[model samples]
Each structure stands twice: as C-alpha cells, then as structure tokens.
Target: MKRPLLTRLLALAAGSLLLSACISQPGPAPRATGDLGLVIERASGSVQLIESTGQSSLARIEGLGDLSHASVVFSRDERYAYVFGRDGGLTKIDLLEQRIDKRVIQGGNSIGGAISQDGRLIAVGNYEPGGVKVFDAQSLELVADIPSTALPDGSRNSRVVGVIDAPGQRFLFALFDTAEIWIADFSQGDTPQITRFEQIGKQPYDDLLTPEGRYYIAGLFGEDGMALLDLWYPERGVQRILDGYGRGQQALPVYKMPHLEGWAIAGNKAFVPAIGQHRVLVMDTERWQQQHAIEVAGQPVFVMARPDARQIWVNFAYPDNHRVQVLDSETYEILADLEPGPGVLHMEFTPRGEQLWLSVRDANEIQVWDPYRLELIKRLPADSPSGIFFTSRAHKTGL
Candidate 1:
C-alpha cells in the first residue's frame, strides 16, 4: 500500500507472467482431415486411420466388435466414420482425434449404414432381427425403428439389405426374405412415412442408387434379373431389367456373391458383375438393356470404374481371387492383368482418380496404385484388411 509507483508496476508485470506460465500450452498443430481415410482390419476388429497423401498409417483404433463383414459411411463434414459391424455394432469414430466418439449395439446383426443427405441422421440395416434403425447423428440416440415385414412363418422379420440414402431425406432398402422394397421418408419427423413396393423379386440380395440418386436398382440372387425403381417417379412401380441374363445356360456355382455396390458406370454404359458367371455385363444406361457381356478370368466380385470413366477395374472371387484386370471402357479390351497377391477384397479410388487403394486380405497389406499408369506406388501394412474407405465418399450419394 505504501510502495513506490515503479515498484508496484514491476510486481504487476511479474504476477502476469506467472499466471501465463501456469496456463496449459497448446498440444499440437491444427490440421484438416480432407485427405484422411480408414482401412478395416476385419480379423482384429480394428481400423487403421491413414493419410492418403503420404499413403501411411497414422493410428490403429482397436476394440470394435466382430468386423467379419463391416462397412463404413462418413458424415457430410467427413470428420466422423460410422462403422457397421456384423455383430450389430454401430461405432462412430472421430477421424481428427483418432478415437471412438460414440458407440451402440443397435441390433443383433447389421449389414451396413448410410448417412442422411442433411447429415443429421444415421441409418443402419440389420440382419438378425431384420429391420432398419435410424439414430441421431450427434448423440447416437435411436430416433426411429422400422422393422421389416414378418416372414411367412411369423417367427422372425425379413432380412434387410441394400440400405441407401436418397434425396429429400429418404431411405430405400430391399427386404430379402419378403421380396419387397421400401422407401422411408424422414423429412416429416422421427417417424418416417413409409412406402412399400411389394413383389420386387425373389431374394433381393443387394442394391445400389445412382450417383444422381435418381434410380434405385436391386440385384436378385434367386433369379437372373434385376429390379429397378425410378426414385423420381415412384408411381410407376418397379420394373424388371436384364431378366434371364444367364441366357438359358446352366449357371455355375457361385463362390461368392458379386457386390452390387461395386457397380460401375462409364459415360452412358454401366458395367455390373454377373452372378454365378465369369463375365461382366455391360448395359446401356439410357435403356437399361444389356449391351455386351465381356468374359473375364473368374466370377467378378467388384466391377468398379475409374473416376474419369475411361476404364474399369475388376476383381474376382476365389480361386481367381489373386487376379485383377483393367478393361478399356470404349473398346472393351482387357488392358492389364495384375497379380497383387491373394485375397484382393476391395478397391477405392482417390478423390481425383490419380491413385487407387486396394486391400489384400491374405497378404495383410494395402496397395496403392497409379490408375492411369497401372503401376504400384506403395504398400502399407494392415491386419487382414477387407474394406478401404476414403473420406471422398462423404460427398457422394448412395456410397
């Protein structure tokens, strides 16, 4: 109280410096997550967060349950990943922090999930009890549960497959056991307005929505045709396309079901894996008619297109699982055949299509390739990886 003015000023400065020193320092430099991705290690029930630019693993997140058949979808902001595990686990992971933000066991068995167009709702399709559960994106709270139609015996609900989000906050899915397709409109509220399309086909195994979200096509396993619905004109009902695609020939035993989500579109042509056959069916997208059937090395699992729509890359099921072939889009010629070791599970293209990332399960590695040059660029170690998902999917519809 009686100190000189200069002495009091010096004391105040010393106290301010001490307070600043006691405060916690910043942890790390802020960075963006645009180039980040994840690789699913199916056997270990974990995911490896990776950086696409460096083609390197950044962190390994563990403790997810039963990832034998897992799929992932990203939020609209591309900051979080929603992993749908076979054991009904819906785990929300924070990509920036490399940690699980929230998790819930929504069903007994789940196939996959999709984020709503508005990015506010997460929808999961289940297999065990068979239905769809919609949850709040932020809190992972159950907002709605729409059970599939009951089976003939009334013992259990029909298995749900091919869940995808469409325009106007709507979800479209196929009921495998009931041979039906349903559209759940969530624009109203938590309780969605349901529209059911009956007798779609037998065993609608999987489905895909076009990039523009105009057409929804479901592939049939019990028959040789596909069911297509025009989302723009729901009143027209479902139409059968590519009926009896087997051409009256005896079908071969299918080792693995060809995934419809791997459907490829180049210009006006669509390339799809033919079930129980060693061929890729090319269709004219305008008419939805089979244009050509290109013979391949084995039963094709994934027939995916390059980003520029210049070429298509195909992977096969066992015992031809070791091979991958690139095909010319216009000429329909086999460009290259690559043997990147065994068990080539999945392939994903970078945002600009400069590079392609593939998961080789048996080899336990992720291979990065220059798609245009058809050259191997790098290899990163993973544990029995099955699915390689990039954040670019967050911007695409029905991914």
Candidate 2:
C-alpha cells in the first residue's frame, strides 16, 4: 500500500471531486412561491397583487375603473376576483393570469357588493339608481334587478347600503332614504321573492354581517343606535338594539362617519364604534345588550378583534387618527398605544391572528405589525390604499 504515494494521492483527489459534485447536485425543482393577496390602491384605480409569505409585490393591475370605493370578492376556487367599483364597474379578473376576464357597467354609482353562498351569484348595491342587481357570477350577466321603489311616498329610488348574502340564497339590503331592509330570496328564479321590513331605523348608513353571517346589523346616521335582523329567524322581523345609545350626551362633531366594518366580536362581547363619540360600545352578544363602553382619545373608525379574539385594536377618524390603541380582551384594559403613522384607514389580521397589516393613506404605505410583541415588522409602499384583502378570504364567509 505504501509502494506508490503518487497513486494514493491521485485516488484521494478523485474521491474529493466526486464528493463535491454530489454535494452540489440540484434537488427537486424549487417550488414556485408568492401568490398571496391584493392591496387596493384607491387613488390609482388599481390593485397591487402581493405575496404575504415573502412580503413582496408581484404586479399592479391597472384600468380598474373608479376604485375610489372599490371592494373585491373571490371565486369559490380563489382563481378569479370580482371587483366592484364606485363607477358601477363590475370586473371579473383572472388572478392566475393577472388580467381582466370580463367587465360590465352595472350602475352609475356603487358602494359595495356581496357574493352568494354557492359563489354562483354576485349582488351589487347601488346609490345612483338605488337598487341591488344580481348577476351570474361566471359570465357576468344580469339575472335580477330589484329597485328600492317601495317607499312611503312611492319614490322610484332610494340609496342602497349594506347588501349581504344570507344563508339559503337570499340577499338582504337596507335602503337609506326608505328606512327598510329587503330580503331578496333567489332560490326559485331571477325574480327574487322580496320581503321588505320597513321603518327599521332612520338613515341606515352602512351594515355588516356577523362573522358567521347569521345577523345583519346596520348603523344609523339619522339616529343614535343600530338595527339588528336575525337571518336565522326571519319571522321575528327587525329588532332595534341600543336605541338612543347616545341620548342626553353631547356628541362631538364627527369629522368622518364611523365605519361598521370595524365592529368585532371577542368572547361573546361585540365591540362597536360609537358615531361622533370617542368610545366603543361593549355588547354581550347572547343577551344583545350594552355591557360597558371603552373610552378612547378619538372617534374609533375600525374596532377590529384579533383573529384569535385575544386583543381588540382601535383606530381613529381624524385629529387623533395617527394613533392606534390595543386593548386586552379579557380585562378590557389598554395594552399598548402605538402610532402607526398618519391616516390609518384599515387593519386586517392574518388568518391565524399572528400579524396585522394596516393601510396608511396619507403615508402611502401599508404597515405590518406583530400584535403579540407590539412591534413593527415590515412596511409596504402603496398609493392611497384602503383595504388589505387576502386570498384566504375565499375559504371563509363574510370577508
């Protein structure tokens, strides 16, 4: 074995080369990544597709008309996004291809819309024509047109708000000028069976369905409290909850309307923002009564609970709009007061409630935060952003 040192050295060199080649060998092809969510750029009339895992932007889709008050809902498969715009534009976009599949002008002015339980029908709430229109989700064809013409004065139109899809293929909406909530049953055909509940409340501004889509709650501007309709038991009609909640108290001048989208339910208590007041109403959901009120520095715009229902995050309208406050869900105590920059329009928690993404309009950026640690993690550049929606919304109801 010691006879030829050169032969031994040559063998060692060859072995080393073989080992290096093996170590550098390519493994299974790297799986493609970064298909995640959408960021609504209000001023630009476009949506920037972003990947949450990587925290990166993929593409900015343009030509979406009048995205000033745009909202989006995904297909059942999450392959397509239906964008409802303020200019009455309904666009079906192929998310995989990053292109618009179909577009239609459904009305002159639109606020928002909802998708059916089966994802087969899309209903839009219009302000200009004051009605809700149902369309075929797949082909974007008109199926039903239910106008809000049944007012006490026999008016032909009334501003529509809070259009939501309930269980059993029924679409429920509230008319602003008419003060009514109409339930449109589409189980039979295009001409839905309209059941109108009138005089529910005065000047219902906006409405939202509970996380489970069981209750439809509408906020009123002309009055103090809200109207609650139990979809599970429609025979009970509409019950006005928290009547004169602001009675006797001198409400501060509201710089902007308090959005009901911020209302959240944590541990059977629903936290709702008080219009023109710097506080949130704590409600016991089971009894449907006001439990307590949590005071804040400014009028709350969005009072959202963490996905895990541990903490409640509150943001303001203006003046104090630059600050965000976190409260302990159990103790109802202030946990942390954070300044996430100016113009905090909306906040969306990840599906698991680990992280929060907030849209800062004046700053033109989206800030990501760790709710548990109360620290800033990342910041994304956006143009007058409003809503931060994830593709995971497809799996859940009333997103």
Candidate 3:
C-alpha cells in the first residue's frame, strides 16, 4: 500500500501504450496465390493445378470420375471449379485448397456444362439420360431436370448437346435426334419458360453462341448447312445458313468429330470448320452468308481465330492430326505450318491472343507457343491432357 509515485506513474504509461497499440494494429493479409490453371488428365482421372505464368504443377487432385472428356467451369470468384465428367460425375473442386469439396453422380453419361449468368446455377448436358439438369452452384443440389422429349414418337429421351448459358437466366441447347433447339428460361420459376424451335436442322451436333450472346449457331451432322437463331428476336425462329455447303463434294471419313468450339468470330467474319471436308467456311456475320472457303491440308477439327482477328489457327483430324496451320484472316493465305506431334486434343489462347497452349495427348505434354513467331517456348509434362481451360473464361458468354 505504500507504493512510490514513480512506480505508479510508470504503470499508468504502460497501460496507455498497450491500448494505443491494440487500436492501431492490423491483421495479416489474405493469402496471395498466383493465377491458377487446371490441366485435365484424361486417362488418369486427375487434374493438375498449375500456374498460368510459371507453367509448373502446384498440386494434383485425383479420385475424379471418368475424365475421358472432362470439362470445368469455374465459380464467379474463381475459387471453385465444377468439373463435368464423361461418366456422369459432377465434382466440385476447391482450387485454393486443392481438393474436392463435393461430388455427385447425376446421370449415366454427361458431356459438358455451363454456369449461369448470375453464377447461381450449373446446367449439365447428358447423353445417357438424354436431357439437361440444373443444379445449385454452391451446394450442387438438384434444382430442375428438363428432359429432351421432343422426338416425334413421344420418346422421353433425346441426347442434348451444346448446353450453354444465355442472357436473362436462360439456357440454349440442341436435340441430337429431334433436330430442335430448346430455350429454357429460369428467371420466372423452377418450372422454366420453355421455348422449342422444331426442325431447326438435321442432327444438330454442337453449337456456339456469339461473343455478344446475340446469335446461337448449331452445326448439322446430317446436312452441310448450319442453323442460326437470333436470340434477340426469338420470333424469327431458326434460319438456315450456308445451305448445301458440301453439295456435290465427296466427303471424307472423319476419325474425330469436329467441334463447334473450333468456330470463331474475328471482326465481322466467322470461321467455321467444314464437317467431313478439308476447308473452313468463312461467313460474314452481318449478312450471315458464306463469303469464301479456304482449303486446308486435312479435315479441320478446330478452327479458331487469334484475339486480334489477324490470323486463324486450324487443327486437323486423323491422318492429318499431327499438323497445325495458321492462316491470314484477311487474305486467307497460309502463314505457318507446324507439326506439334500426335494426339493434339485441344488448344487455348491467352486473353490477349499473344500466346497459345496446346495439349498433346500421346506425347503427354502441354506446349506453349508464340503464334506470331511460330516458336515453342515451353513444354510441360502432363498425363494425357485433353483440355486446357483458363479462369479468364469465367466472365465470357459462350465459353
């Protein structure tokens, strides 16, 4: 009780200093991870997380179902990835934690999926069950199941392809057997506003929606033309473009089906691969008419344009699968020819189109290149990599 005044004054000053420190101190910042990229290992049923810049694998996630034709769509924040597997397994992967958060088997066979414009729903296209299923993006809960039952015979099953998100909480897809285009609007309620445009085309294989989300184009497998739907004016229904494009021409045996994802729009023109043919159908988007056809070495599998629209890159099917060619978008001249070796499954371009990444399955490697210079920069090892998807696609319309 007989403490000195100096001791009491020192204690009071220490208390004041501690209070000031607590008020001004800050917490640790959130973890700063690099731009993460995923490489789908087709045969091994695993995914390799790699840096988009460094080209190094950071982690590998396994136990994903049959990944033979797996594709991934990322969450709006890019923290999670919803992978659509061929064996009907939908896996929700946490990119930051490098593990599976939730998984479910929704069907017998699934092709691909798309995330909604609002980032609240995930819709998958099924081949076995022959319909599309919508799910809650966060919990992966089944929300609605719209079976493709538009066949003439009243069959409850019809394969759905090219399931893609559209504006106004809607989805656009094609029926493989019924040759119809169906639009499901979910903005109103769980019972979607369904709009069916029948007889759109013969055996519509795959479709692509324009960057502006205005046009939905589907390629016909039974015929040479493609069906175009003006989403802005749904009253016009579907119009056929480039009719009889393969007329009077002998077709080649396609070892691998051509993907409409290969189709690209550069400036005012769209470059489309001619099915069972060795040419690319160039169309003027404004008029939707065929402008010219450029001949290539083999049947084109993927025909994509550079971001700047200065050039187009074309990949071929078997017998010519090992070759890749670049073309001048304006003059249609062959700019470069590259043989990146066999089993080249897919390719992706940087946002600015400055660089390109290609997956070579048989070689078990991913190749990065400077397309303008036609030089290989990096070759990273992979396990039968089939698809190279970037997080940058999260904002795009028709990814």
Candidate 4:
C-alpha cells in the first residue's frame, strides 16, 4: 500500500532512503520468515547474510572498505537493493546476488546517505558543498540537488545539519547551520525556496519527521530538550517544546554534535540516547514533553524500538554497558541486558523483532542476538564498521 509514495517522500524530505518497498510475491509467497539477519564483519570488511529460517547463504559481499555506515533499499519490484555507504563512499550492493552492481557517485559531493521508500531515490547530504542530492530510484540519476548553506557571508556556507523526507514524497525538510530550514519538492527542478526560521530555541542536529508528516521533532545542543517545527504553516516556522529532560542537555557526547548521534520514533514516543548521562529519554510525541528517563548502561549511545512497539532496544558506544539493553515499552523497565558486541553503537532487529543485529565498531565483528531470549546466536566479522541496517522483507510492519 505504501508503494512509491512513501519512499519518494522520504527520499526528498530527509536525504535518506526510508523505503518500505518490499514485496510479498504474486499469488502466494512463501510464509515470511521471522527476520533476515545480517552481520557486518568489521575486521574482514565483509557482510554475512543469515536467514533465520535456515536457508543457504542468500548473498555475501566481499569487497568494502572499513564499512563505516550501511543502509538497504529493495527495489519497488523487489529485484535489487540500493546500498548507501557512509563515512565517505557510495555504491549499490545487490541484496540477492550479494555483489556490487556499480559505484554510484551520488551527486559528486556527499555527507550522509538515505534511500527512498520505494527504493527509487537515494538521498545524500553533502557537508562541504553543504547541500542535499536526490537520485532517481531506478537509474541512480541525479534528479535534484538542493543547496542548504546560507550566504550569511559570501565565502562561507554553513553545513547542512539534517534532512528528513516528507510523507508521500511531496517535500524535503533540510536543516542548516545558518539557522535556516528549507523545503524542496521533487515535482520540479526549479530552484528551491528557503525560509529563515527564527531561532526560538536550541538548534537541532538530528530530527524525526512526524507520522502525520506535519511537524519535525529535533533534539537541540544547548537546550535540555527537543524542538518541534510546525510544517502545517510553513511561514509560521518552529514551535518550541524545550522541556529539559535527561538527555537533551548540550554537555552530552551525543549532543556534542547537533545531528543524530542517536534517535528513533515509535507510536507515541521518541527514543533518544544521551551518552553524557548514560540514559535513554522517553518523550511524549503528542505533548513534546519528557515523560521519563529510562536508565541505560554506559551512556546510551543509540535507541531503537521494535516494529511491534513492544520493546525498546539500546546499545552503548563505549564499554560502559558491555551489553545491549532491552526495555518494555509501556513500563520503561529493563526486560533483558544481553551482551553481544564490543563498542556497540547501532543495531537493527528482524522485521518480527525477534533477533538483534549489532555493529561492533571496535571488535571488528557484528553480534547477532535473539531478542526474545536475550542470548547471542553468532558473531560475524565486519571490518571498520560504524552503522547497520537490515534489507530482507521479514521486518515490514504493514503500518
């Protein structure tokens, strides 16, 4: 049902492929498995694809650099995968064949990467050039390039902080260092128009696009909390929701930079990791208020919730927690503290949320955990890895 719209919307809005372009086959597809497990080996510089249903190797990619950042987008027809590389690289990794199709330049300049929902657009945030680029989903052709730097001065253009695709791919929300935000539409290549938002509160680094796609929730650096930008009235600009909770304070390591050190959004809550205080803060999305601070280990580095919204998963970037922590969503209580990888920062669960995949930044490996039981199932090697995302269809939530 999401089809082309969701992916296209996200491709333009956020500079990330937020594609939900998975297919279930024609008349009758096989019973979907619990999850498609991927373990990125930091040392070997390879990716291992594991099927929980006990199938043979779906595919394995051999040549990749340190493997700093990774995200997968299945084609709208479920034929190929557009792989976005992070930490300065670009290319598409075939999910089924487990091979490199081609190296995509992605606008010549690059910052961070994201895929369109239908896997048709690949978005990139270019830091030095200070702009965002969106590529055609199928051809990988440059469709639009949006510059975010403000000419506050002639020579210097500030960095573009964050990008989020709008629902249905109508527009893109871009944050910049000039304290300005702009909206870019995919329907036309006409120059994008910019609106300077009055800085009412802390400038945010990373942000979440509301499900309604009307407001963008951002975590600020100097302030103790998040800010909400009202998209309902574009000219009206940002609305302050600076409710100081445990993690939004600028002193935290994650807050050290204004963008997403870690952020995730679910039904009614937003999960953020505050490395400075070693905790995960729960925010009420409706009220934009801090509901509670869920204490996590080693300065919560990243927080992600399962599709079911039943459990919240967290990992510490440093050796502080030595294990991944799982919490019950409603009660905000610890369900399990399972050790999986070293220097754990980013992770993803199978579509069913039954298994956990971790990026062992320091360990040169990825640790796979059975989330239900909080136990380690395997440790696969990943070379110089930074982040991880799952591509197999088992994780789709129909929502």
Candidate 5:
C-alpha cells in the first residue's frame, strides 16, 4: 500500500526507538583491579577474590587441586593471579571475571611461583620430581623445563626452592639437596643461559632478593650461616656471611622452617628469623654481620617489616603461634605483643602499609589491623586460610 510521506517517517522512527530500547540496556559496572587480591583457603583447595578497599570477599573460586602450602603471583596488569598449589597444580585465575582462566598440573608437588619482569613467563618450583617449569603466562603452555641438579647418589633430582624473578628476565632458585644456587637467564630466548653457584651452603632452604634486586641471599638449614650472591658482580660467586652465628650451641627443636621471604630490612639493619631459636637476628646490611639477637616470644617463623620500615612484625611456630610481637625498627625494642588468635599462619601488608592482613587458620578468619594504631579493624571469614597475598606484590621484586 502506498503510504503518505509523514506516515512512513513516523513508522520508521518508531522502529528505531524499539531497537535502541532493546540493545542499549545498562550492563555490569566496570571496576579497576588495583585494589583486588586473593586469599588461599588451604583445606578447600580454593581462593577468595577479595577487594582491599572494602576489605571484603567478592567471590570464591574453587577446584584448585591442593593448597596446603599455596602461594600466588600476579600478572603485570594485576588482573590475573597465578596460584601455585601444593599438589603441583598451576591455576591462572581471571580476577575480574572471578573464574579459573587456565589450569595445568606440571609437577608432582609444587612450592611456589613467580612472574617474569615482562609478565610473559610464569615459573613454578617443584619439590617432588624436583625442578622448575616455566610456562607462557597467557596460554599456560610449557615454555621451559629446568631440572634441578642431580643428587649426590645420582638417584633423583634435587628439590628446588625459593624461585623468584629478577631484573633482566632472569630467575633465581636454590637446590635443597645439592646446596647450590642457580640463575636461569631468559632474556635472549626460550633456552636460558644457566649460571650455577655450587656449594653455596649446606641445604639452601630458601632465598630472598633485595628490594632493588641487587643481592640474592639463601638461608642454610644444615649450618649456622647464609649464602650471599651479589647480582651486580656475578663473577665473584657466592660468599658466606654470618658464619657460625649459632656459636656451636645445641639447637632447639624447629617446629617449622622460618620463611626467608619474610625477612625484614629496616634502614641499615636487617631482621632475619633465626631458625630453631626464639631470637630475631639483626644484621648490619652493609657488612652482612650480626648486630643483635633480640629475644622474641618463640621460634620466629616470619620476621616482616612494614612498608615504612618503622616497625617489624614477628610470628612464631606452633605452640606459640597465637602470639605476634611488634618491634621498633630503630630502637629494637618490643613495642606490642598481640594475641590475635590461634594458628596465625601468614601476614601481608597493604601497598603503602596502611593496613595489615593476617591469616588465622585455626580461627578461620582474615583479620585486618591498623598497624600504626595496633587495633583490629575488620575480620573476614574463610576456610582454613593460609596465605593472604595482595596485588601490590605485582609491582614489587621478590614478593
């Protein structure tokens, strides 16, 4: 039928309005990921996506294999979290979408992982079958397989520990059974240039890199000292420091190994957990010499410093795990002794050290504290929480 021009224009306008109404509906709100983080639920093999700003859990992602001793590293954008599970499961999670983006079982048992400087590679350190596996950060495909040194008996590979990323696309780790430190340089390509430092110590339990990535220090379990490697001058090899700090005294029973990653450096002094002892070893960072051994509540498991380096927080092993002592960095005095709850497993500070997040496994809670005020601000419930990792670690070295 031939319609009038005014009638045809009105019909077309009505159709346009209908289409616009159907397609232009509002969607979900967009949010930034800078304040986002994850908390590891050790027993359930899951992680809770948490936002630091609101200090609440946004979502829970499950089906991660085993998380008994899980740890996480974030992509450069902080939008993805790479969780290394104790069952050797490497799961890449999409923080914004709140889902597992990819998963791979790369080893028999895994300890931890780290992301490359360019955020392209993800490396996992395996405890069983012993070695490290590097994967493509986006695809979760194997990129490189670095087998740890063979054992003294040539039976199996040595267990790898303390895998951390360095500047220049290099990854550093220690061989537990072989007492060695290795640097895998990948700046060139897929095949890494290996730099091995043998006999660094007896049983290099764990390692840590300086804030600027200048030095790599590995703590020894079979001895009283530690091994230090100056990354700036690799030709000089590893040097032994703090030799015989134990003074050949009968060592106390160690309930748990002290985590070297929790080492604290405040100004010129470095506070390290003295294994099997109830004292925190304060060392002069310049000479790497022991300055003081401040007595603490128990065998210090984690001696961590606040971001401002004003105070240090020390957590203990079992039996005394309920107590956490705060120490003044300058005065080296015990400022506060807090008994938050039983089974305090891990602690993490906010980006600027505004709030401290602690995982109380026995209480099944994540307690947020105002470090300066020394007060508990909030608590979020979880299922056997062990590690509280924040996105701020994405920008830091050796987190």
Candidate 6:
C-alpha cells in the first residue's frame, strides 16, 4: 500500500536530474530530460551543487590540492564523474557514492577537460609544460602525451594552449601557442596518437570545434584576425584561417583582456573578446567575415553564451566594468550589460538558459545573474577557480 524507500528515492533522483537541465536555462526549448542539476567549483578550490529549481546544495570533493582550473564531465553511462584538477591529477567520482572514489596524479599544471564521445579516454590541458596528456578514463593510466610539437623542434619544449573534444569529428584537439593543432584519434582501441600536428592559427588562443566537426576555428590574439584551420583534409594539414589577427598598426585588439581573452562561437557567429579594444567582435561563421563589433567596458575576459537560442553573454576581467553583457544573436547588439560585482571572471549559463553563473575571483563568490533582466539574482559562497556544470540528477555541490 506504500511505495518502498528505494522506489521513492529513485523517483526523486530522476526528477532532480530533469529539473536541473532546465535551471537558469537560456535556450528556447525546455530540456526533455527534466532530471538535471548543476555542479559549481570555486577558484579557491571548492565544489558545490545546485538543484533543478535553483536550490543550492553542498559540493563534496576529495584528494584535490591546489586546483587551478578544473572541469567536471559526466560519463555517458551516467555511472561516474571524471574530475580533473590543475595539479594534473584525475579524480573519479562515483555517482552512487557522490564522493571521489580514487585519485590519479598527473604531475603538472592542468587546465580543462576533453573526453571522447564514447567516454573511453580523457585529454587534459597542461599549461606550464604546454602539452596534452591522454589517459584511460577507466584505468586512469597514462596513454600518450601529445606535446605541443607535432613536428618536433628538438630544442625548445612545446606547450599546449588549449584542448577540447570534437564529438562530431571523433578526435581530441589540442592547441599550442606556437600555432599548431594536435589531434588524438579515439576511434580505435590503441592509444590515441598525434595523427596531424602542424601550424594552423596565428598564436591560437582557446579553440572550439564546430558541431559538425569539419573545421577548427581559433582566435589569434597575436595578430589582427582569427584563424580557421582545415582539419583532417590530410592533403593540406594546416592553413591560415581566412580571417585572423594580422599584426601591426592596422590590427585591432580583438579581445578585451590579454590575448583577446573571451572568444566564442554561437550558431553562425564568432564572438571574440577584444580586451584592449573594450569590445566583442561578432563574426559570421558561414561567411567567415567580421560582422560588427559590440562595445563593452573594461577588459572583456570571457564570452559565455546563455544556454539558450537568442542572446550571448560576455564577462569582463577588470573591476571597473565587471559585468555580464548580453547580446542579441539576431542583430548582434548589446542588449544588456549587467554588473554583479568586482572581479567576475569566466561564466556559464544553466542548461535551461535561465541564469548566468560567474566565478568572481576577487569577490570570492559565485554570483548568479538574471541574463534577461540583467540583475543580480543571488551570490553563493564560492572561492576562486571553481567550475559550474548542469546535470540531470542530484550530485555534490561544493562551497
């Protein structure tokens, strides 16, 4: 006559996951998976959790020390969470336990995370050494280390600037400051190797692969334009992107902060953070042409698009104009630039595209903003260098 405890708990978990996917969502359509939730990490090295309806919870982390910039990725099977830290260590978070199950030391400065579509392998960006080290997600064993050099210099140590997984392309792409793209093939059982590593963008900033995974577009802060590299064509392993930063007097500072800090692609547009220029460049992805520049304030540090369909959000590094500027995707105009507080760094929109969560370093708090009204929604107690994610089920939330 009464529901069992296990049945009740399972139902609650499913509901939580669905609600999480829609929390602070930005896009047009609501998530079909209503069991989602959010995971946030602070720069001060703490992690937390948020429910579907914007309820906050405590984040639990284990075996992580001196975490710089880390990323939390949910395994496709939804059994475990693969968390990587700046200390070059990997922690496997068992979903059932909701705590770190094991730790694997990577021995370097880690950046973000990239995993194969199948969730078999993981690739992490190591900055100081400027390389991408691959590991077996299940075993956490060293698979292969893809250095910044595809064609070795034999002299200077190559360093990795950016790394991301291209699902449509089925390969892991890593960007080096020296202007090269390294790909780890995950189609086979063997360890992923550097199949193509050659010069592509001009001192490429962070990179992102198109949804189709045909081309890799990179921001060239060193020059006046961005770089569009032709990937996997094989015949031409690398080509200078049509519209990238061309150095000299004519070249404009495309990014607001250092190296055009906040660059991103939304639908058919490329939003670039012109730090010194105090603006964001909207480029047509199809035409590969510069559309128009939307002006912001201070130094734009990150470009975070509302997880919705219409507007894109931008964040600034400098306190003088630390805010989240929302732009209409259609007209590419600055609709609203809302200031939450001082020192708002990178940010991400909830899967439902309702709220904009920011990692406020100096303020030592994670501020949630109403992307539409441009008002401060709430400020959660968080530290520096933390990460935020959306999920369908209940997980741990850190402070």
Using all chains and alpha carbons, the TM-scores for the candidates as numbered come to 0.95, 0.89, 0.93, 0.76, 0.95, 0.77
Model 5 clashes, total count: 0
Every candidate's CA RMSD: 2.0, 7.5, 2.8, 13.4, 1.8, 9.9
Tens digit of per-residue lDDT, candidate 1, span 279-386: 999999899999999999999999999999998999999999999999999999999999998999999999889999999999999999999999999999999999
Residue lDDT tens for model 5, 295-332: 89999998999999999999999899999999999888
Error of model 4, residue 370, in angstroms: 2.1
Error of 2 at 164 (Å): 1.2
* Model 2 worst lDDT window (10 residues): 28-37
What is the full ranking by TM-score, best candidate first? 5, 1, 3, 2, 6, 4
User: CA shift at 127, candidate 6, in angstroms?
Assistant: 3.5
In TM-score terms, candidate 2 sits at 0.89
Give the backbone clash total of model 4: 29
Please list the residue runs of candidate 4 whose C-alpha ends up more than 4 Å from where it truly belongs after superposition: 1-52, 55-58, 62-66, 69-72, 86-88, 107-109, 117-119, 171-173, 188-203, 211-214, 232-235, 246-267, 392-399
lDDT of residue 383 for candidate 1: 98
Instruction: Report lDDT (Cα) of residue 219, candidate 6.
Output: 59
- Where in model 5 is the C-alpha error above 4 Å? 1-25, 248-250
Give each model's whole-structure lDDT: 0.93, 0.86, 0.88, 0.59, 0.93, 0.61
Better of 3 and 5 by lDDT: 5
Minimum summed lDDT over a 10-residue window in model 6 is located at: 390-399
Q: Write the per-residue lDDT of candidate 2 for residues 1-399, one digit (tens) a residue.
A: 375988989999999999999999989763332246778899998988777776777788998889987888888887888889999999888777877899999999998888888899999999988899999999999999888865567655899987777788888888999898889988887789999898888999888788887988989999988999998898999998888889877878998787786688887899999999988889999878999889887999889999888899999988998999998878889999999899888888877877799899999998889889999999989999988877777766654
lDDT (tens digit, per residue) of candidate 3 on 41-129: 99999998876677667888999979998888888888888899999999999988889999999999999989988899999999988
Q: Which run of 10 residues does model 4 get worst, by summed lDDT?
A: 390-399
Q: Candidate 1 — which pairs collide?
A: none
Error of 4 at 301 (Å): 1.9
